[model samples]
Target: MPETPPRARALETDTIRRLPKVLLHDHLDGGVRPGTVLELSHEQGYAALPAEDVDALSAWFAQAADSGSLARYLETFAHTVGVTQTAAALTRVARECVLDLAADGVVYAEVRYAPEQHLEGGLSLDEVVRAVNQGLREGEEEMTALAGPDRGQAAPAGPIRVRAILTAMRHAARSREIAELAVRHREAEVCGFDIAGAEDGFPPTRHLAAFEFLRQENSHFTIHAGEAFGLPSIWEAVQLCGAERLGHGIRIVDDITVDGRPVTDDLASAIARSRTEPEAFALGPLAGYVRDRRIALEMCPSSNVQTGAAPSIEKHAITLLTQLMFRVTLNTDNRLMSATSMSREAQLLVDRAGWTWTDLRRVTVNAMKSAFLPFDERLRIIEDVLKPAYDD
Candidate 1:
């Protein structure tokens, strides 16, 4: 028999679903509704999907993502990214992404996708941004309309306020161009920049010029690191490139040790049971720096498990890190692939890690603080919306 994890102030499933959320690391291309994917595929004449039926297709996505087959998991994206080449498809998907998050109780979100990936249909980068931005704006409007007329501009503050993060593929050479595009459209739905792909061989420093340009322009960016790779990936993202927030910075946990053993739940209990810190909970240089600096870790448990960054949701390092008070925030890296949402992510943590409402609030605030929004506005929402809703 296993010992049950202790809880503090956990909320019920319904209550957790009602809590407001802030999403900082979500992919636009990866979150399309399964039915929408099928519709777009049929409309666009891309017939490569494994299943035409939405339910079967949705199940296929879940199984591939959960089956430990990285190649099969990635093939799901080929279908999604394949159908989203047209501007109309991009706009619809972007709009639906916003609406879905809003309906899921996300008050703020930064959805990211590679503009380069949508150019197969001859749409320029600017046009890609334009279509996505238009969809986002329209989505905001439709969601607002769905809410009662009493909420005016306050609607966005409650329903959802979305911003687009322009992503550049890591294995490609167009990072500098994408960085420029991100900066050029900063005033639009575009809010920041990122580079994401396999982190094994392609270190973030490969796009140093792009990062340098963002620095020169005084912009914000995040790098995908420490997911499939290790500390070296995170080190370069933070120390080398100045990433404001780490996308899946889970491997930072690798730096912590206690009595020569890593800090898992079992090993950590030994240190805690001993009631001594002389050799207990030692933070390696990287983990110490990250914990001290409060760099937010975008811990996508389901996606991490899919990619082998973690073994299972219950044994995820996020549980250990959260207990140790690292800046752990939950995100649904790809909803369609992971069959997850912000609410589901929180509820899973509640179940697997014995997280309380307080823990949920802390991570929500963590993501809000690390959001690309201006600090004052971020603080405003934390004060006006999130804190009060949690109190209720």
Candidate 2:
């Protein structure tokens, strides 16, 4: 819970953009390549595309996903989902996703997807998981080979590492099954469980049995909460369901007040006390708990603006969230939909938030610290990968 000092250099001016980063909340179905979507959709004879050409199709996705409603924003996934039903399609997309993140300078990433959605091609959950894993491994190998001798010597590591998080749709009744699947495939490819979908009515508490099962097995899980709803959803994600982290916990601001606007004190003792007391916040219990626990927020600024979570880039809460010492990590919630990259996300934070290099380093390290992986592994990424990259 210690707050780092801010620096004068902007995020783009910072050395950390070249520094390795860890991504924990990205979605596979949401990160597909538009060109791949065109080819795969054609191969499968799926006809839901807004445009046939790859370039036009890519623009079409961006335009369609720009709708403010989260539901309508999510509708673009049907085109992506339709193309990804087959194992070959899934592998290709997964591989390209890894390559894309690597190109964006991510040292480690965990991409989540619901296996049930990909079963439309008659493939079982395990098969889909293996195919995606194979794709990741293949992509990492290719990246390593392409790193070249000079860049390899300059870069202090092998190719980027990726893990898969098996997501179960919130509206579906298969949470327990998916939780078991995640635990069952822990060594193979699966690293954790997540419940992704609309967050308004389909709260995390609906999957108590699954969360309980995961807790019993000592498995890691992050809940998609507070993106489209208010503090109630975030409260349940943590208090009722025991989520280790909240994906896009943007709505926690609804509880705070800063200069008559929403902003929690960066270092308030009362807010800090809520880490364990759970009910100590005079402003909002949810905000206090999140702040005290040091729970990381996987914030995707561009996607938030596109979905109307915020009105614009400059006015986004992420700027204030970082300043408040919240454990905030920049992420690409849906790369295809937002037409974004992790580097682009960082650059946008710099351009709009006036974040310094130190700010970028601090947030990236916060992400490494908050990763669902074990502590030692996360530390290794921070000390071995991130530190060297930024220091150089």
State which candidate has the highest lDDT.
Answer: 1
**Which pairs clash (backbone N, Cα, C closer than 3 Å) in model 1?**
none
**Model 1 error, position 314 (Å):** 1.3
* Winning candidate number (TM-score): 1
Query: What is candidate 1's lDDT per residue for 136-187, written digit by digit as tens?
Result: 9999988777776675433333468999999999989999999999999999
Q: Estimate each model's TM-score.
A: 0.92, 0.89
Off by over 4 Å in 2: 1-17, 152-158, 259-283
**Per-model C-alpha lDDT, please?**
0.85, 0.81
Clashing pairs in 2: 258-261
lDDT of 2 by residue, 1-392 (tens): 65333343334423444557778779899999888988887788998788989889889889988998899898888888888888898889988998888877788888999998988889998898888888988998888887756674344345788888999999999999999999998986578999989888898999999999999999999999889988889999999999888899888877866434344443243233333443332446677779889988988889998988876666677766676677888889999999988777878877765666776788889888887777898888888877865553
